[model samples]
Each structure stands twice: as C-alpha cells, then as structure tokens.
Target: MNGVLKALALPVVLFTGWWVLSADSESFYAPPLSQILTAFGDTWTLEQLKADVLPSLLRLFAGFLLAALIGVAAGVAIGSSRRLRAVTEPVLEFFRAIPPPVLVPVIMLFAGIGDAMKVIVIVFGCVWPILLNTVEGVRAVDSVVLETARSYGVTGTARITRVILPSASPQIATGLRQALSIAIILMVISEMFAASNGLGFTIVQFQRSFAIPEMWSGIILLGLLGFGLSLLFRLAERRALRWYEGLRAAQRSS
Candidate 1:
C-alpha cells in the first residue's frame, strides 16, 4: 500500500501540474495534459498501438536476446580462461568505451539502415554491460569455495555448474538489469534516428505533421513502455536472486 501510494502520488501531482500549465499554451513545447491524454487514447487504441508498438518491441526483444546470449557466453569464456582474457580484455574495454551512436554511420553503411542494422547496433550497445557484469560476477566468486570444490572430487563441468554459476548468478542478474535499461533507451533512439516504424518513428512523424498531442502521446507511450519493462525485469531479478539475497541477509544477521 505504501509503495502503491508513493508511485501514485508523483503521477497525480505531475499530471495535475501539467494539466494546469499546458492547458492553453500556444507553443508545441507545452501541450495540454488533456490533449495528451486524448492522443494517448486514440493512438493507444489496440489496433493502432499494436501496429506501432509491436514492431519496436519485436526488434527490442531480438536485439536484446541476441546480445544477452553472446555477451554471457563471451563473458564466461573470458572470465574462465586466462589466455582468452589476456588477449581480448583490452579490445573489449576499448570498444565498450566508445558510444554505439558514433558507430551508426559504419553500421548503416555496412548493414543498411534496417532491422538488421538496428538490431546489430542494439546488440553492440547492450552486450558490454552484460559481458562486464558476467566477468565481475565470475571473478567475485569466493576463492575459498573454489578451492574447496577443487579439493573435492568436483572438477571440470561439474564444478563449474555446481559452484561457479550459482555464486555468480546474483551479479549476472544485476548486469542483465543494467543491460535491459540500456537496450530500452537504444531501441527508442535507434527507431527515432533511423527507422520508419515504432513509437520513436511515430513521434517523429507526428511532430512533422504538427500534431503536438499525438507526438506527446508517443513520448508518453515510450516512457510507459520503458517503465513497464523495467518493473518486469526487476521482479524477475528479485526472483532469480532470492537465494543469494537470503544468504546475504543471513550473513548480515550473523
């Protein structure tokens, strides 16, 4: 109830304030809250929304999923193998330091400004956070536990499955959370700057059409999309790391 109230309080205040401030603004910069809501009602109608949002979501899922798989694999390999880590660590760091937006030109040139290009960009943009997080999670595993497992009959695949992965699950989850946020932002940005579909594209189209309310609706929908996705991912993270969380709490109490 307290959490519910906290969430509701901000939106109530913000919407009321926006309603007052933008009710009669002549500029597109301040569209009335009522009009914005109306635009949301129209644009977010099931048929209209499905047409616009589905494509973006499909793209987002594809790119994000691809990145997570490849990133986790690469991360595990790098984290586990000293030789691989030694060779690729600098290169990974160098590439990660560079912004994905900067590579749009090259990506568009090579891949063409389509789904393939956008998905690839999203993959490149999102993979680093996940990969780095996986490496950190793996490295942060307790040395004592590792040694004990080795002392036991646990070697090779058994040890990795029984020990390393469980130890690193928490941080990998955290990394996924971060990567998801980045992916959402990149999805909109990629669509906005490049494509002819998605919420970003719809917003651009409406803005050009001088449909202020509709444009604002696109922005609102985008916000809601990101928020909904974040909340869902957070719940998943909590569920996934419940065991680790319990262990931490026990440790604190002890």
Candidate 2:
C-alpha cells in the first residue's frame, strides 16, 4: 500500500496541478482536464473500444510475440556459433541502424497496408533489442556453470534449455521490457498509415476533424493503456525472474 502510494504520488500531484491550472483555460487546443475526462467517457464507448482498441492490441501482441520467438531462437543459434555470429554481425548491425518507421513504406510495398504490414513493422522495430540482448546474455553465461552442466553430461538441447536460457534470462527480460515499449509505439505509428480503424487512427481522425477534447481523450487513453501494460510487464518480469532476484539478493547480503 505504501509502495503503491509512493508510485502514484507524483502523478496525483501533477494531475491535481493540471486540473487547478486549466480550470478556466479558454484555449481551443489545450482544453481543461474536466472536459478531457468528459470526452474520454463519451468518446471511448464500448463499441468504439471494440472497433479501434481491440485490433490495435491484437496486432501489438501478435507482433511482439513473434519478435520474441524469432529473436530468442535466432539469438541462441547465433550466440552458440562463432562463425555464424561473425557472418551475421554486419547484416544485423546494418538493419538495426535503419529505423523501423522508415521501412514502413518499403514494407507496405510488399506486405501491403494491412495488419501484416503493421505487425511486421512492430516486429522489425522490436526484434533487434531482444536479439542483441539475448546474444550478449548467452555469450556472457558463466563458464564455470557451463563446465558443471557438461560434467553432468548435459549437452545440446538440455544444456540450452536448463543452463543457457536460465543463466541468460536476466538479460532476456531486459530485452523484452525494451521491446514491449517499442511494440506499443509502433502499434500507434503503424495504425497512422493506411489504417481503417485503431487507436492511432481514431486519434488522428479526432485531430483532423478539430475535435480537440476527443483528441486529448484519445491521447490520455493511449497513455493509460501504456501504463497498464508496463505495470503488467513488471509483474510478469518479477515472477519470471524470481530465482535471479533471490540470487542477487543473496550476493548483496554476502
């Protein structure tokens, strides 16, 4: 309870300040918080959420999951082989240097302006972080641990699953946390181009039609959604890394 209060303290103070300051604002662009809240309630009806928000979330999860799978698998393979890592390093760096948003146009040429294109854009943006982190993690696995596993006759798949992955999980979690934020951002960006219906689409529509309150509401909704997802990710990461956390705690105490 104390932790939660501490977490929300700054936001509550900032929001209160905004409400008080903007109470009598007359600006067309920057409406009062009360008006934005009212618009949020009116604009984001259940039907609107179904039509717009659902599709965006579906695409986001799909792209993020695919990126995770591909990144981890490829990272493991590449990290396991010196020759493969050497051969792919240049290619990986080249692609990673190119911003994912820039490739949206090129990707649309092949993938078309559909969910596939959006997912691909998200995956492209998110995969590099996961892949690089996983590679570094795998490479950084303790040699003593590897030797112990080998002494016990663990090899190949057993070694990877039981040893390498667990040892590398901390770094992998870092990658995942980074990728998730990218996924959300790309989800919005991808929807901005040739999209029929989505949060980003709806927000852009609201802006273009001069519906400032609705636009502000959409922005608020996006921020809330991102916050909720981040909170969930932290919970999941905590659960996933329980052992790692315990180990670190033990080391610190020692």
How many pairs of residues collide in each model?
0, 0
Query: lDDT of all the models against the reference?
Result: 0.84, 0.94
- Candidate 2 residue lDDT tens string, 1-254: 56457766877898899999999999999999999999999999999999999999999999999999999999999887899999999999999999899999999999999999999999999999999999999999999999999999999999999999999999999999999999999999999999999999999999999999999999989988987898789878988999999999999999
Largest lDDT belongs to which candidate? 2
Candidate 2, run of 10 with poorest lDDT: 1-10
Question: Judged by lDDT against the true structure, how good is candidate 2?
Answer: 0.94
Name the runs in model 1 displaced over 4 angstroms: 1-9
Worst 10 residues of 1 by lDDT: 1-10
lDDT score for residue 37 of model 2:
96
Candidate 2 Cα errors over 4 Å, as ranges: 1-3
lDDT, candidate 1, at 209: 90
Give me the displacement of residue 138 in model 1, in angstroms: 0.7
